[model samples]
Target chain A: MSGTALTQQRDLFARLVTLGEEVTDALDHTNVVSTLGEEELNRAIAAIGDRALPDAATSALAALAASVERVIAANDPHRAIDWIGMQPRLALTLLAATLNPASLPKDVVPPSSGATVAARIPAGISFSDAPRDGRAVVYSGIQADPILRPLAVAIANATPAERLIARAVMNDPEPTAAEAAALFAALPSHRTTTDPLVVGALAIGGKAQASNAQYRGAVVEATTAEMLRRRPVLANDADRLVRRERRFAIDGVSADPHPFDVTVEAGPVPELWDCKWGARGIDASLLAELEDARIRAAGSSARIAIGVVAFDTAAIVAARLTIVRAPREKTRFITLETLGRLAAG
Target chain B: MARAVSTPPDAAHPARRPARFATRGHDAAAAHLATLLADAPPHALLIVGPRGAGAGTLARDAVATLMCGEPVDGGPCGACRACRLIASGSHTDLVVINPTGESNTIKIDQIRALAAGFALFSVEGGRRIALIEHADLMNEDAQNALLKTLEEPPSRTHVILAAAEDSRLMPTIRSRCAVIRLGLPDAKQASELLGERLGVDAPTAVRLLRMSSGRPGPLIDAEATGDAARAHAQIRRQILDFAATQPHARLGQLGALVADARAILVAGDDDGNAADGTESDDSSDDAPDVDAEPKKKSPAKRSAKPTPAERRAAATALLRLWRGVARDLALVSTGAVDQIAFPEDRAEIEAVAHRLPPATWGEALHAIDKTLSALRRNGNPELLLDAAALSWPTL
Candidate 1:
């Protein structure tokens, strides 16, 4: 193959793989959008009926329909079930076509009734070879195949162009400039260039920015730990006073104790501190740890302080809100700027 | 005939005695184990390493040292009554548990029995040691059952868990045990050991060492290792031949490729199962019959037809090997021949690499990875293989 043709083939291969991955992710229920309910499902089908799909999506939908028909025609129930389960969008399209044959465009047609539709039913759900009358039976069969519902939901909720963009971004979390350009070129021109999905994909696709953010996070963590270690109370007896990435046994916590970023033992009460770089770093798990520490220190004269030292003001606020249940006196939600004071106190 | 002098009972079956704990290229881990045995050893110890890297050997040796009447240089003397019994797999106090039955998992019942046994006094008035081989295979309930014993074991009891993949183990179980990680042994030591064990010359031993990736487990099992190596060689040739064919004709080679890959995996498993069987028979005869189900079922499974799970596992293993081949081709194409995995098949690899651009090899690798991912999710093997074959660059 010529160089240009080879490149184009590679690009096409990447897109197909990305779509497969997204379908798998949807099956695994890790997609950003949740599965559509009965009402929403009907609305999506109605909306799709009115919209004029791009040539690529129309072809893709048609291809999925054709593939389903072929698998059913092969008279292999196993193959038919597997083929449908592998692609959520295909399963959705099939279900939509079965529900309302008139809803889809003339180019894409649902599989005809008889043994073809009967074979498409997953064997796990029903072994009966009899043709089902209602859309309910077909819907139930699709539901029995675990990947179909969530995948169909994700596909139906998002436009074809949007799903394509999402899959591309998902495939390459950190794409190079040239890769980003190629991705943009592949996207349908109908979708607005200024859409948030397009803008977000471009922003995150910059490999340098992702690496820089990671580097900065590491630097902040190290710097915070060093500053805490340099405090007068913690300086003289370094080993005993400060520990990094250490897990301490607390009474109430079950299983293994979480490894705190920094643990200071110089004060009367032991202090476990975790350093967060940005607002996104503050989460529920951090709060649970603080609460567990609080429970362990209950009814004791010496109060163990479970803290989070965040660099961002927003993170500190979020941490404070997240740990509202924990006693204020027993918790230390501070910033790096106040690390020295907190350590000294 | 001259009057026969009376031999000691322990010396009656000298050939049957357990071999002294010996390993190649795990000096630091061995030393640490020795130190722990001599001093206050942890109640629970986790020996983490790849399968065939000698984690099982290390764990067994550690147990022997703990139970030995006379330990020499922190190892079992192999002459004492305890050592003799342990070696012969008749030690009353030593218990070994492995994944058993069709599921191939260490179940909660087996673990509960082990815990129950530990609650009692030692049979021979020495330290009671339990070695859990392939501990990573233990299901969640089994791991949880083991956690209580790991946290607070009875006096004079030590549990050693040997696992190929430590990540499969629960964090609670891992945190409770002192971990000893075994890595690839030193090249010189491994080569010498392989040579001595296989009775091969230095150059052949060196080649075998490289092929086994410096792992003593595969090298020591000469027959299985040899079979696997031969299968791998055949696979390299097949890949090259397939690459030379037209795109449409390449599908014809899929069956041969899959069969060759499965052969390689089965060869490794045959040796592994044999080793496990011997160990199980030796240990279970004297210990409690808690793992009786697995013991009874393993031989039958071995002789019978392969289960679907086993076939899937073999297919997964083959895809992994194919991924490596694709990566090696890319490396060879980029003039990094030294980094290629199959250095022995350099000529064939070069011939294949010459036909495709380095980028094409990368694409092939990606395609294989996607196929592997799909297979793991229980996709139809035939369909996935067909797609993979179509994706590869045609000569």
Candidate 2:
């Protein structure tokens, strides 16, 4: 934490808070908060965080906190702590930093000290570490399940190379030069101080973003095309379903208002996918939005749970990363490795 | 050119590509790739499968499709010169880093070299495709170096990691690339494909397919490796006899057998000169004549102990042999006789299966697996084998 880094981080926090406030106020005008239950508010907040908002703003932060406060009308002390347990600590810190204590869920106080900011969800994990101050994010929880234990350890004790790899895989937006140097130095040969991010961008032609978009498109189309090539599963399934990039409007006939990145409506529920590649890859926001979509589409006769398919694993990791957002137990997260598993399922 | 005629005239055929991956169980993968490339393939791929699963072939095919001017049939149309170069592995645009020989470890330098090459423009005016075979062998640094390329590869570049064990790869590496795991073909599909491709009869095809766990790659390429298989079969029989020996005598016999085996295979080379030789000679004098060696009179002067490499290879081969035999017993016990790797040993296998219950074979398999695990962790070969001999079930 250099002084400059601190300033930049604070600026980022401020900007994020301002954005959240604008969104929150818009929702308030529509009286969406009045209709939302605590679970839904939590889901909405998770979605907003997924958009990569980290910095904060004063007025907007309070306003956003106020909007959510209306949904959970409690002054109970334990209630606030419980609410804080599931909340994205960093975003909530920024939002609540300026709010009157009453606006926060009953007993919850934002992480400004040694509070258990990040709670361990599994009943057995006894993690209780909070950030020492407003400027840090501490991870103290451990997953106790046998299957996940190894993965948790591996993640916790990730080598520098692994960290670099994770950052790259996630397409983390702000990979430092130090990471590049560390990555290069860690390798047995061809050690250099040159940035690896540059190396990545150049591995594919300057057209990676464009290329991935194509890959994303292909995954959607080719899976369908392969099915078509094999023959129709049911007669005229293709005729009944149309792929919609737009969200299916409330009026039910808009060309462009689909809640997802790609949607195909051939089956009982339209297969909704939110495709992304990069560091901010899979986050609380997308899962939150997808969760919201799943909730909204529950009443539709031909609705499917919004499925997430990431070309990059970072998003999947993010989806699993329970520290920031609540673990999306219900959402289906798909990656390249699990393609066969999904197909079989 | 008269080269292109069916229902329509063709300029180039897909067969012009250097290698063709025609596996039955992986037809769906191949077809899916074709469909993906029926438009444009993804820039990075993590191909997961066991060795000899046509991982390399699929990678090449994908590259060929990407770099070809007028790609056809999910691959490069062969009629073009680029396709021919791709087939011949002479195309400048295609770079394959095979971690074989002294370069068993794909180090960071190799990836750096690749990154440098990728940093430049493509020579063939098409996508630059780099195939990393046995990518799981890459040292951690190499994988890290490769991260950059994986994240945002060069312009018109496609990087494919052909890995045997996906778990060996960093999850980040696994995450960055799209993974496609190739399945082993069923016995019937393998038999059909082996018969069709190699023109082998149903019985031979079945045996080959069974030996390869229903994967046709090894069977298709069997002609090249047939001698080694035969040689190892003989070696296995010797090891099995040693295993059947009384426990008290096993260690002494094992030491003598290895020395004799090494001497016979290495042409009595006293100088450990052939330690790193890739191929062990198929022919070896079976006589265990430790007394016959001229240097036997002077224990201090005996200069012909196997080199570390030879010793390691021998240990590995022994473990493999034990595993193979134990596997046959287990398979027979399970009544999966058709899945036996050594179809020719049916009589002996049946006898073993009948003489001992499936539990005996199961115990043997478990012991063998444990021994192999210890050996992998750099256990002293002689000591480990001695322990294994006592613990292993007698046929």
Candidate 3:
């Protein structure tokens, strides 16, 4: 790069950081981040990273610059970015960082932006409240009403242990051994992990499935088992055998029970155990199945217990079972916490 | 969540036209509607708007004109037999599908029945009309069920689906209709209309108009329900009560309050035990009482919120209602005479009449807006409630 261009690039980096700071403040204060054109920041980011750029890069860059200018015009110079709202600011900043390779610190890993952020935002909040016609809210912690700034900062600064805890807390209100396994699977690369590809594979079940209120616990269990296979300490070459499936049935005097909607089978389970996921543990209504399992495994003993897993504000009472007795009636009920403690031990 | 806001059993008054104001910014849309109504095209027509913006009146007017069997310019001749029946909501050709008493959703089956009827014959022996109110509340299945009817509307059958929220309709549903949008009158026009037409005192009419956000339906409905002014007072009072409470505990209390309010509205004062014993005694006498219970229960329950999600939801809902009420009251305060609020909330309205300055109310609104945005993220719901819980009382 020529001296003038190099000088301009250095100036651009400083300007970008300042923009980031202003965007953060704007989000913290008001709602104006939608006035941002992320494309402009991408070009700057691309130049900083010295990598190839897409054909659309130039137009996107112009749009970003124009948006910034619009934001400036909407408010006084002193209050330029300070007037934006938190949500829009966070959205714009996250969007810019996603497009720019250089934004991630040397040690830091990056996540995708746009629909990813939209997806991560909890369901109950309405995007309708966000200004649809103009700008998204800009938040960076320097505003009178700082909503998620501190939380964002904490996530950005999390240590390995803290990140693990944060991940678990975010997933299951009550982090169980199963939940931990899912969190482990979700962690960023460069964090110490036994096997990266295995962890990635585990998360491929996708957050959409993982965060579902009904399926989350089961998803955690299934994902954790997969994560363990990466290291083999928990289990090796074992896959989920079957999971709970809802089916309408008849209480007939004579009829065979059939299940539909979903089913699973172990790839190879001569040396493996099946996993069941539940909040109050498996349903009490399913006790007949437990008894049947016990009867089917007469040579083996079974146990079942209710587990109390405490989250930040709530607790899930679950039932865990291990087939040790042959008779289904001989099956035992154990709480999941006890199992978690046992696993931890 | 909608409740009666007007005084109870006002001296009987003659039926008048559905409330209306000057059509602004929507002349082209309205003109398109007029032409379609003139031709009585086989296609269904959907008129959508925010709650209280008067979409229903537009639909009613269009139907009246189509079935008039006599033409006088583009508007309906209010004196004609067809116009009279449509206005009275008893026209055989005009089918109105509303929630059955306490039922909330406009069911798919209900739409199917309406479609079937439309498929049969016209009562007016002219254009068959179906006006579905609160059209947005239709579930996806119901919306889809209406799609076939909407896409290929029967000969001489006109369907007008009106909603307070237009976005709630399926794009497919929307694309099929010629949409007519309605908006609240400007302050001056709304003020004049309320005073001359509704018999509201000049000053109170202005207040009702401002409080109703210049929207004629809500402006009229608020007076009828008598809850608009009362709700504004209750919201203000509740915010003050919450503001005094510590943040952490306030959310839980607010949430509990909201749930309890819903329960109370849904269940009412006859303690479950008492109701069981009296269940067979006087069903008719008890039914109205039961109906009245929810009217009381809803606002109280809605005002309860401890978690941010519930709090923000409650607050946002309240704000939507508040805009109309405050507009009514503001008109009253400003001495504008176009709209008169229902007389029921007169007492509460008077009590809070100048408790907070207008600017402070504006600030409280902004704070509520902030809480709503935060509720959208992964931020703790409790914290969001905390923010509102703190700011709400100060207003």
Best by DockQ: 3
What is the TM-score (0 to 1) of chain A in model 2? 0.33
Best first by DockQ, ranked: 3, 1, 2
lDDT value for model 3: 0.39
Error in Å for residue B254 of model 2: 3.9
Q: What does the lDDT read for residue B204 in candidate 2?
A: 62
Ranking by TM-score: 1, 2, 3
DockQ of each: 0.01, 0.01, 0.02
Candidate 1 structure quality by residue, lDDT tens digits, B322-347: 66677778888889989877677789
Q: Write the per-residue lDDT of candidate 2 for residues B136-218, one digit (tens) a residue.
A: 88889998999888877766788877766767788777777766776554557667776787676777666545444444554
Ten consecutive residues with minimal summed lDDT in candidate 1 chain A? A117-126
Candidate 2, CAPRI quality class derived from DockQ: incorrect
The reply for model 1, stretches above 4 Å from the true place, is A1-345, B1-19, B191-212, B218-222, B225-227, B266-307
Q: What is the lDDT for B108 in model 2?
A: 86
Off by over 4 Å in 2: A1-345, B1-25, B100-103, B185-209, B212-244, B248-306, B330-344, B353-359
Query: Best candidate per lDDT, number?
Result: 1
